[model samples]
Target: MSSRYAFTKTVKELRSFLTRAYPIMKKNNPHVPILIREGTGALPRVYARYDLGQEQTCSLEGLSDKQIEETVTSLVKPTSL
Candidate 1:
């Protein structure tokens, strides 16, 4: 059996997150690819993948689409000062 079936609520939440997150994530960081993935928390995690396939996950739990848009901007920003 798939976890998707076993955890319908989680699946629903995850879907809701991705639906809202995809557009905002793309607009904020168009240069690189963004990924939304399943996580240990209530909300899904978003990742920014580098050219070499390295990934860094960020949280958007309980965040509205507008909030996600703002927050994801920060996540993809240059880590170095």
Candidate 2:
């Protein structure tokens, strides 16, 4: 993945996850930039930017705060293979 990521904020149910995960994701992965977009009325989603302009999108419509946090963390700080 590239050194950046983004998240969408349109639903009230995602507020807590976005708030808590965003900061921790920033702190844990200082080299990667984190971005947030609000008021889009889009379905909750997480985006991971990758090399060669490739990107990945994941749905977070039904995930809890903990689940969302885990998903974001995994994307931002992937395990070394």
Best by TM-score: 2
lDDT of residue 80 for candidate 2: 41
> What lDDT does the true structure give each of the candidates?
0.61, 0.67
lDDT top scorer = 2
Model 1 pairs whose backbones collide: none
Instruction: Tell me the tens digit of each residue's lDDT in model 1 across 1-81.
Output: 565553565456556656877787679758765544455534555666655667677765555556656666786677742
Q: Which run of 10 residues does model 2 get worst, by summed lDDT?
A: 1-10
Q: In terms of TM-score, how similar is model 2 to the real structure?
A: 0.65
User: How far in Å is the alpha carbon of 34 misplaced in model 2?
Assistant: 1.1
What are the per-residue Cα lDDT tens digits for candidate 2 across 1-81?
221123332244478876666677678778987777765546677899877686778888767677777777677665442
How many residue-pair clashes does candidate 1 contain?
Answer: 0
Q: Model 2, residue 43: displacement in angstroms?
A: 0.9
